[model samples]
Target chain A: MSEMLWGIVFLLIALLVGFFITSPLLIIISPLVEWSALMPYTNRSKMTWLIFFLSVLYLLIFIGLVSLFQSNFNGMFSKELALIFLSIIVVEFIAVRTTQKSLYQLYEQNKWPQE
Target chain B: MNKDLVKIILVTAGAVLFNLVFWNEKLAINTVLFDAFLLCALFFLYPNARKSAAVNWLLLGHLVSLSMVVIHNTDLSKIAFVITLLLVAGFAEYIHRSAWFASGSMLMNVVMIVASFAESFKINKSKPANRKGIGRFIRFAIFPLILVIIFFLIYRGANNAFSDIANRIGAQLEIFFSHFFDFFSWQRLVFLLLGLLITGSILLKSKLDYFSTRETRMNDGLQRSRKPMRQKRNGAFFSFVEMIMGKMASGMMALKNENTTGIISLVLLNVLLLIVNGIDVDFLWLHFQYKPGLPVYIMVHEGTELLIVSIVLAMAILLFFFKGNLNFYKRNKWLKYGAYAWILQNAMLVSSVFLRDYYYILKHGLAYKRIGVLFFLLMVLIGLVTVFLKIWSRKTNYFLFRVNAWAGIVVLVLATTIHWDEFIAGYNLKRRNTVELDVPFLLSLSDKALPLLDTNIVALQKRENDTRVINVNDGQPACDTCFIEQLKQREKQFEQRQKEYTWLSWNYADAYTKQYFRKRGLITSIH
Candidate 1:
């Protein structure tokens, strides 16, 4: 019911749709996490687990797809294209997930002593 | 029904179009078709944007420039198409908000597009009533979907036996999935992202209205500020200038002295230009002759370059003199007259440049630089006219820039409407008897001229033979059959490349060449 729960829910949806349907859809989690960070009841532990699961989910799917289709790929250019796709995916994962984690850590580090 | 839903559909459709049309091909009709789609999307999304006549003109310009890509597709036309795209997007977004300048609007369009991605992260304070429905869908539907995918992938990768079993169960779906993922290659993915960005940039208006608010405060007309000039903190140079002027440095007297200086400078410059123009009229205009081996390298190239630089310098001088309070001076009539005479003389100088280029073109036939000189001269003429308008109406420097920028864009776009390679080939081949047909130059033209060259192979061979004899007499070694061999090689290469192009990369000139080759049985009719 809270904003935090909604954010977690969208993150899960983003991870699912991104791995199954399209990788670009994974970008939705960025804004969701950003919005959730502003909420009062945000739980970093649950958010971390979801983010971890998201990356692992993508890696497994990527491995499965490559194993199935790598031989079917036609040329050196196709393999290079797949590598580029993987590189971009890795960059996106780092850019969105790692940046959010650092922001949460930064928030905790900068908290007042009394709080 | 929802605007966001419509936006998503438009983005998906645009990405699909991008993937299908531009997945590794040269720009041609496909670019024009894509632009038309963007324009249609713009109109549907921003219906009121058409009410702005400026927006309508920009859209037309965008379409015209984009159409040039289909017609000939030069570097100039491609650049113009890109610039016009930004102008159209910027104007459509801020049509009613500001008196949009081309450069500023383009910059704002880029900024807002990039900023919108970040702006999406902001929390929407206004809550919709259907939030509970979305929440229910996510909790029930998304939660299960995510779990199924995670377990499916984990089990599939962790155990090959399970993977084989899963593969058997999903063999039909695997084929479909593989077929679908084939579309997600890196280049196509990049294209899809580009499509999303372009669609989002034009369709999603950012909250940052920096240019709009700033341009709203600006006016085209310059008002005479009666306020005293801000006194500079005296550097050594300022004090030295003030000391040199004595009593004339500080007030109305300074304006009078400046006006006198401007009038005297313009008078001297006008006299000098008159002498130059007189010489040009005598040598380049009336008494022009194409002497074989007549140092044309110096006559046309150096002469035209010098004259253009002088004309540009003359404009700079006029802008300098009429920059500020000099226009409001009571004794500025003589200065204004001097400027008018100078502008008239500069116009004559531009004509002289045109004549020089024309004579060169007549003698040597068409080339890129000669055509470039014509367009550059046209832009200079337009710039001169805009400078005159600025002085007459007390307009700001921005007005001059705005008008001239549009003129430059229109000229560049119009320049690409004709295939220059074909024109050059036809012109040279037609005048092979009178004009010095530079066989090597013709060979260097793009493959668009293949049809013309093939038809006039005999004329080209004759010219090459004449050149070879001259080279032999000059004690240089020259090959007899090398020219024809090179021509044949070029023809074969063009044929091979043309046969490979699909409908997505079609161009009029290229298609014409293909048809020509096919008619002669050089290429088969299958493609």
Candidate 2:
């Protein structure tokens, strides 16, 4: 029971970190993600629950990946790999920033629907 | 804007806070993965050409290709990554504008999009009810915090059992409280305020009152003017506005004048450029061995700087010459041709610079600066082409700006994808003439240098040994022994490249090098 409790604590901690870093980016892109995920499903309730389930899945996958990284090299770092990782983040940031700005402008100028 | 978006925002914000509080670290794959997932989510968020959110097959394919390059992360795959990214940018431009071969206005679109994030927030004065609610929240939180502290103090003073219970909860609470409280530190507080501002702006993203509001204001103005213009409220302010407007009008009139001073200046400048280009081709290219003994450093460095500045000045001049009356400046054919000739000469100069750089690369092996110079020259060439296109098509400045922006983005993304250290190391090592090879520079590269260097280890080892066997009979160290010292310096570079095997920082290239070195018994197996 204690072990299970600690596991839950660890899981919660991991989820929190993953969410904060991912939130601004997700919030920027939320309208599109909302549209894409909501399009195929007709019921709002069902879609919301489905989206919630997906977030959980995303959280679990993130934890697993972090675990794999931890177990791989025992904690030393490679400059090249760090560079590769940083590049991905930089590219991603620019992409999302640009796209969201476009979406915001469209919605504001054209009254493109808040829903 | 929907409740679902609110929920997603809430959850994502919670995650960011969690990372900051619990999992913040300098080197983290978790951070990388979270970022990747968010980026993948961006594909769905992207607005289509028709101002709709739609996910097509091609978009998905592009996303998958990039994700693969990011995840699989090998040398060859990075090449594919760069090409695909450029293609993605071009495709996005095409779809957004509904035009192939996008012009320069697209660059403005990019700037507007990047700038739009500032519009994502808003701040409104807090109403009494909202303040009351905030007060209530603080009261609830502080009261509980006080009770917990007081109860804990009592429990410790009361008995062993109670004290044990309080201590356990206190231990856990300390972790939570410290992490939470850390958010109030000066730096973190500043970030939190910034985030609040951004989030508020996003939450308050104005439904662009731009067009509709303007229309209403215009109608109101017409209605007000129908009643007869009101007496000027402030004559001085009106006079100031009028004076500014007059200056702008006069500036335009001056620009349109036939005796525009710049025309004579341009004539002299064009003649000077012709003379310079004449000298460049005649000597710098045809009979150029400008500095044979010196390293190709000066040519690649100084020459690239000179050529770029020349092209930029040429652009500023071209833009100036084409402005106002000169657009159709009655019978300035010689001037137009002169400008074209100057631009054409700039293009040739870029090529000549490239040739010199290539010659340097061939002789001295590749360096980061050389590679960067190559990319810069590519931009210069692109700028020159845009200038030519601008003149030929009589396109707007927006077209020039847009194409150049796209060219720059493509070049940058392409350049980033290359594994330069490995490429340079391999290229230099492959050069047949060892005498021409920059052995010392090659030795200084990362583990990526090893696979190629492995072949020449025997020669390097011999030279390393010969450095110590210097002859003192001539009382001079500057003989065959100097070459041995050069080789020794190359060997000494190995000391800097110690293999580190931590999952948090492991690079495949480094691991490969470590294993290879271990097999050769040059380094210990940390694994």
Candidate 3:
């Protein structure tokens, strides 16, 4: 009974830590990147799909890491470590796209007349 | 006529009615005192209601009396009666808008009824006031009174029901208080305080504006007017937060709800497993020299596996919530399909466990071994399939992949049910042999020594045969030749033991046997 209780406590702690580390990135970066990628100058549809694919791949990687380390690691560190890696990757991806938003808008303006 | 006095009367009456109907002697007195205090507090808080005290008191008294009578008789059934009265009074007040006293009385009655009913139902449905001659008068005079009466009745009914049940089933109040304290041990309390701190920070960030005014009569009118203003003040943040919270909370709630149910069921299963394991362990420890079979170990293994599964499932739910608004499946059609496949696999795993348990119980007369193998297989299958699906969904987009995933789930469930009885029987035989060895000394005693000893043995043996043991040795254990041979062995042991000692001299042995049977929970003494 004690072991079971400890396991639940550990899992909750790990998840909470993961949420704290990820929430700021989700609030600031992800939406901004999605908004920028929809600019007319860029290939909006393709970019959207690319971003979506990358997110899925990142999630899958994290899922894999969690399963692989489930038995080897004890307590919060194992789960939190995997989630942090996933969150960082997402933040970097979103930052890259947002930097190019103005360029994409200019390109869309140039292409609109020809279309 | 002072409005403050009227409001006080209405509120007090509502409280009194609530207490009489719902509260037991102990709780009723407390409720009545609490109500009186609340009335005084409200009046002091808003003094403008002083003019209409008489009408307010009259309405309050009526509401209290009606509520007590209705609630004390039949709790929930009086809802219709209370609702009908509110409707009648509301219409009457609407017709007599010019008479402020009548209108105040009606409104007070309505508020009292609604408050009382709301407490009982835990819902907040209120009747709108009518503005249009006779309708206005009727509404003004009776509507408020009716509302007060309804609220009183509901509060009384709910309180009474909870108290009565608590009293009858032993003092649950004490148990609840103890459990509550235990639940909030220092560490848990600290966590709760931290959670509250976070909530406070969020609330502060939202910056809610509170209503503040000095005129008592105007304050009541102001509260009604401020409803729309309050909504406007927080509309954007409210909607945005609600949208985000709803999505996040729903996923978490679903997972939490499912896992909670699963954990409860799993705990019950574990307790059952523990009892069976303890009996077998005790038997093996006391009697047999050799180690028990794989089936015994298998049962323990299954219990551990189920516990692990429940934990994992619960964690999965927690993770889903913590992930925030990132719903991969909902955002992408392909991922949704993958999620559906994953759900199917999970359902299959749960069903397989149920089927396996059913099979084992049928074969083993509630012994542990019969159910162990099935649970072990289920756990392994679930772990393997989950990982496989996660990998496969990433690699393949073929329609056939989906088909195969679903097919695997169906096959897993079907196979468990098909061979359930045979599997159960194999385990039961192992358990029966363990029991016999454990209680060999008791079995050897003379018939006169333990008056019901022979009957107990026969009944146990019969149950073993009738239950899962028949499947052991391919049903050969119950065959005529095997049955006769087993009976002969028992008869020989009985005679040998009888010659060795008299009934009175075997008191120590008798006591030991009784203890063993009690521990096993198999000794039905009434027979």
Report the number of the highest-DockQ candidate: 1
**Model 2 CA lDDT for position B271:** 78
lDDT of 3 by residue, B1-527 (tens): 45434443444454444433333222222333433443453344334443454425333543453343222212211332233233223223222211232334444433233222222222123432321243355446566976675554445455777547646655665566546545545334334434332222211111011111111122111011223434634767445645655544234354344334434444554455456445544643344233346444344446446645653663354233222222322333333334344444444444444544553354334433434545455654554454444333432212223334334333333332222322233333346644432223333333322323433455555554555564675634344233324444654564455455433223332344344434544333222
The candidate that achieves the highest lDDT relative to the unseen native structure: 1
Best-to-worst ranking by lDDT: 1, 2, 3
- Ranking 1 against 3 by TM-score, winner: 1
Q: Could you give candidate 1's per-residue lDDT for residues B1-527 as a string of tens digits? A: 76656666776687788778877777888897777788888778778888888787877777887877777766667887887777777777774333345356556444444344333343354653354355455446656987797667667776789888988979976576557557656566767868777766666665545567677766678877754445432556446757876667666677788787788899999899899989988987788886776756567787678777887788888887887777777878888888888888888988988887888888778888988888888888898898889888888776787777778667766776777788888888888777767778888888778777777776567666677777677776666655567777887888677667788888776777777777865422111
Return whichever of 2 and 3 wins on lDDT. Answer: 2
CAPRI verdict on model 2? incorrect
RMSD in order of candidates: 11.1, 14.9, 30.1
RMSD of 3: 30.1
Give me the displacement of residue B192 in model 1, in angstroms: 2.4
TM-score of chain A of each: 0.33, 0.31, 0.36
Judged by lDDT against the true structure, how good is candidate 2? Answer: 0.51
TM-score of 2: 0.52
Q: CA shift at B475, candidate 1, in angstroms?
A: 5.3
How would you order the candidates by DockQ, starting with the best?
Answer: 1, 2, 3
User: CA lDDT of B442 in candidate 3?
Assistant: 36
